[model samples]
Target: MTDTKAQTQAKSADAGHASAPKEHYDIVVAGGGYVGLSLALSIAQASDLKVLVVDPQPSERLRKDERASAIASAATKMLDRLGVWGEIGPASEPIRDMIVTDSKVSDPVRPIFLTFEGETAEGEPFAYMVPNGAMVGALSDAALKAGVDLIECDSVKDFAIEGGMTSVVLESGHSCTAKLLIAADGVRSRLRDLAGIPVVRMDYDQVGIVTTVEHERPHEGRAVEHFLPAGPFAILPLTGNRSSLVWNERTDDAKRMLDMDDFTFSLELERRFGKQLGELKELGPRKGFPLGMTLARRYIDPRFVLIGDAAHGIHPIAGQGLNLGFKDVAVLAEVLVDAARLGQDIGAFDVLERYQRWRRFDTVQMGITCDLLNRLFSNRSDILRHARDFGLGIVDRLPGLKRYFIEEAAGNRGDVPKLLRGDAL
Candidate 1:
C-alpha cells in the first residue's frame, strides 16, 4: 500500500534512500474537525503513540463562523479532558434552567409546561452553550499542546490497508503509515465511501434556521424550548443578554423565511418567541441547513474505523449530535490506550470491536430517540398533541422523573469514561 506513486515520491523527498521509508505515526486521523481534533488530543495524552491530524482547512479559519451549536453536559467534560475547558469556560453561557412548553399561538388557554433546574453534586451547571468555532479553536490548541502533529492545508488523497498497516497518501505529497486509521471527516466522508461502508439515510423534510441574537433583557441563563406544530424553537443562553437560536421549520418555509429582510424575520421570531426576552436584535446573518440522519453500515473495517458524524448523523432536536461524537472519542480513546498498555495490538480486530460494542448501542438509541421526537412533535393532530401535553404535565409534576431527566441531561445517568466524568484519561 505504501508503494503507491504519491507515497513513494513523498518518502523519497524525506529520505536519501528510495528503499527506506520516512515519517510514520501511530494513528492518522482523516479530517481535523471537532471530533478528529479531540480524538487526537486524547490519544496523545493517554499513550506514547504518535498521532497525526490531517485537515484541508487551516486551523485559524475554522475558528470563525456563525454556525450550528451543540448542547448536553457530556461535551463539557470532554473539553475538560482535552485541557481547554478553562479557556472556553469564560466564553460559555451556563444553562441554569430549561423551560419547555406546548401550545398553539391562537389559544389563550394555559400551556402545558415543564421545567428543569440544572444541578450537580459539585454545584456546577448541568450544561453550557459555546459556539462551534470556539470549541474547535480550543481543540486545536489542546491537540498542539499534547504534541500531536497538526498537518493543515492538506487532505487525504487515498488510503489502503496491507500487512496489518494502513497507509495514507496526502495531497501535499506526503505519505503516512499507521496501525489504525480513523475517519472523522463528517457525514459526507470520502474515506467511509472508500472503505465501502453503506449508509442508511433519512431526510426529515426540515431545515434548521440558526442565528445569534441580542435581547434587551438578560436571559438569566435560561433556555426555552417551545414545541410548535412545525417543529421546536430552542433559545439557548449565550453570554450576558445574548442567545443562540435553532428554529426548525419546514424546508420550503425556512427558505422563504431566510429570504425575508431582517425586520420581517425578527417579527416572525418574536411571534413565536413571545415577549420572553423583550426586543430582539439580529446579531448577524442567519444560516440554514437541511436536517437528516445517516448511519454507517459498520463502524469498523480491517485497519480502519469511523467516529463522530462519519459513523452516524442524527436530527438535532435533542442537541446531542456533537456530544455523541464526544462520547465516541471517549470510548475509542479508552479502548485503544488500554490495548497499548497491555501490549495488545492497538489496531487489532478485538481492540476495535471493543470500541464498537461500547458505542454502537448508545449511538443507535440516541438516533432513534431524536427521530421519534421530530416525528412526534412535527405533526398537528389534536389528539396526539393533547396526549403529548398530558404526558409532559405528568412528568413535570413528578420530581423524581424530572430529576432523572435532569441527570441524563447532565451526562451522569449511565456508565461513562473517566474523562467524560471530568477525570484524567
Candidate 2:
C-alpha cells in the first residue's frame, strides 16, 4: 500500500482549502489499533476490497509502547493465518502453567487454590505473553504488505450515511466514502457514538495497575493470579526473567498508589507480589486503567459496524481483553469476506447482521462471566471466599474441568471463526 502522507498530499491541501477529491474505499476502518489493523489485513486477503484505516496515532508511536498483553491460543492462530504471527512469535513467551490463589495482600499464607498446566495435545500452549509494541509492529507490517491503506496522524472527525455509502470526514480534512465502516476506536469509541450506538456499562469501581518487573528467579513461564480482597493481581510471565503485572485495586487506592514515589510504590507492590520470584525490580512505565464492562447495544447500524473494544469492554480478570478483540477481528473478517465472495454488499444490514448475531451472544456471555467472577472473588466475606476456594480446588482436582477451562482460556470453545481456527478468510 502507498504511504497515506503521499496519498493525502497528492490529493489536496490539509487546511482551509477547496473541496478535496473524495477517495473511495470498500471498507473504511476507524482507529488503526490491533483489532482494526487485523480486520484490514484480513479483508485485504481477497485483494479486492479497498480498505483504509483512519488513526490519529502514527505507527512509530504505537511500536514504541512498553505494555504487554496475553495472546490466547486462538488469537495466535488468527495472527498466523494473517501472516503476522511468524514475525512476532519470536518475541512471545508461551504460558506453560497458571496458579490461582485467593488471599489478601497482608495474608501471611497465600495458599494456591487452583493450578492449571496449560498445554494441549496439539502441542499448542494455551497463551503467550507478547509485548504490545511487538504485536503492533508485526500487524502493521502485514497490513501494509497486504495492501491495506492506512491514513495515519488523522482520525475520523465525523461521518454521514447516504444511501448505501457511508461518508467519513477525517480530522485532516480528507473525505472518503466506503460501503462499510468498522468502528475500532476503542472503549470510548467516538465512531460508535456517531453511529448512535449505546453501550451498557457496569463499572467495577476498580482500576488495574499494569507494569513489568524483572525478577531474580526464572518464572519458567508460570503465571499467577492472586484474588486479593480488592481485586485480582496477575503476574504473567514474559521472556527472560521479567513478568508483567496486572494489579487490580479500588479506584481510589490505585490512584493514590500511582501517585506515590517509586520506593513507596515498590514497597506496596512487594506486599502483593510476595517473594516467590526471589527479588523484584519494577521496570518501564506503570499505568492504572479504570476497570469496567461495556457492551454496545448493537454491533451494526446500516453500513457501519463495531469491532473490538468499541463493541465490548470487559474486566481483565481472565486476561481475555485483547483476545476478545482479536476474536472480533477474526469473526468480522470472515463475515465480510464471505459476503463479498457471494456478491452481497458487505455493509448491507442483512450482511452485517450475520456478524452481530454471531458475536453478540458470545460478547454478552463473556462480559457477564467476567462481571460474576470479579464479584465472586473480590471480597472479604469468609464464607463466600471459602466457598469459592472450595470450588476452585474441586475444579483443580477434576482433570476434565481443568481441560474445559484451558480450552475456554485458549478461546477455542466459542463460535469458532475460520480465521481464529488457523484458516484463511
Candidate 3:
C-alpha cells in the first residue's frame, strides 16, 4: 500500500528530527501498541493535537502478532468512529452466541451452566473476534494518516516533569518534550516506574496457552468457555473454520505441555477441546503467557499518566482485559481533548486528575472482579463448584439479568465516553 500524505510527513520528520536537540509534541505516548496507537489516533483525528508514539518494536514486528483479541461492541464503535473499523470489520468474526461450562478435565460430559445469545439492545453482536495483527495494522495506518508521529525501534527510557511539560529521554538518547506523557507501555511498564507510580499486584500462578486451530466444521460464530480446575479454556471463533484458544493451565503443567511432542499436545488439547467441531489441526505457533493482575495505585503523576496495561492488567477469565484498555483510551482521550478545547493545560494536575478520577474506580472494580472470578472458578472445590454452577444457571434463566450481562460485556454499561458510543469528540 502507498503511504498517505501524513505518513510521508512522518517519515520526513523521523529523518529530520533524528539528530535534533529536542522535539516537542502536544502529547507523547510511550508505547505504540493498540492502546497507544488508538489513543494517539483518537486525539489527533478529533483535534489538531500533535501526538507522538514511541515503541521498542518496529511497525513490521507489531503487525506480525499472531494472536487475536475479542473486540467488544463499544470498542468497535470507537474504532468505527476513528475511521479504521472499515478495514478491521472485514477481518473480524462477530460472536453470535456463547456458552459457559464448568467441569473437570477428566469429565466425560460437560453440561452448560450458562448460554447467552450475544446481542445488544441495538441488535449488534456483543463482541467480535479480530486478529491482533489486523487491529494493530489498521490502527497504525490510521494513526499515521491522522498525523500521529511514530518512532519505532525506540522507547521512552525515562522522563521528568519540567515546568508544565514532561521531558522524555528515549533509549537512543534522543529527547523530546510533551504537554502530557502517557505510559501505554505493557503491564511491566518502565515508563510507569520512571514516573514513580506504585502498583497493587497479584500473581495468578497460571499461564494462558494461546494458539489457533482450523476445524473441519464451522463454529457458527459460537464462543465457548470451559471452566476447568486449572483455569478457563476458551474457544473463540475466528473467520472461516478457524478458532483461537486461550487455554489456561497451572504454570508447571503449562511448561510441560509447551515442551510436549505435537502428538502428545494434540491429544491433551483434544481432551479439553472435545469433538464438537470435529477434527482440528493446530495452526501457527502456540505461546504461553503468565497471568496476573496489576493495577497502578495512581493513574497519573503530574504530566505523566498511565493507560492500557500500564494502568491495569487483569485475568482473561471474562475476556475484558483489552476492553478495559479500550475504555481507558476512550476516557483519557475525551478528557484530554475536552481540556484542550477549553484552553486548559492538558498536563496540569487538575486536568489529568479528571481522567484519573473517571478511570480509577472502574479499573479497580474490574480488576477485583476478574481476580475473584479467576480464583472462584479456577479451583476443584466441589461445594464451591456446585454453588457457582447454580448461580450461573440462575443468571442464565433471568432474562433481565442476562441482558444486563450482555450489555456489560458489550461495554455499553455506565458512564460511557462519547467515542465509545460512536460519537465524535
The C-alpha RMSD in Å for every predicted model, in order, reads 6.5, 4.0, 2.2
- Cα displacement (angstroms), candidate 1, residue 315, comes to 0.9
Best prediction by lDDT: 3
Error of 1 at 7 (Å): 33
Write candidate 2's Cα lDDT for 1-425 as tens digits: 66594554334323212233237989988888899988898889854898887777887899999988999998899888887888789998999999998987778999998999978655799999998898987787667766677767788898898877998888878798999888999999998888888889888999999999999999999999999999999999999999999999999999999999989998998999999878789995999999999999999999999999999999999899888899888888888888988999988999988989999998899899999999999988999999998999899889999999999999889679898899877
Global CA lDDT computed for model 3:
0.91
Question: Cα deviation in Å at residue 171, candidate 3?
Answer: 0.8
Taken over the whole model, the C-alpha lDDT of each candidate is: 0.83, 0.87, 0.91
lDDT of 3 by residue, 121-152 (tens): 55689999998999998898878767777888
TM-score of 2: 0.94
Q: Lowest-lDDT window of 10 residues in candidate 1?
A: 12-21
> Which pairs clash in the backbone of model 3?
none
Clashes of each: 0, 0, 0
**Model 1 accuracy (lDDT, Cα):** 0.83
**TM-score: model 1 vs. ground truth:** 0.92
> How would you order the candidates by lDDT, starting with the best?
3, 2, 1
State which candidate, 1 or 2, has the greater lDDT.
Answer: 2
Tens-digit lDDT string for candidate 1 (96-151): 88888876655554364799887655567888888778888878766766777777
TM-score of each: 0.92, 0.94, 0.96
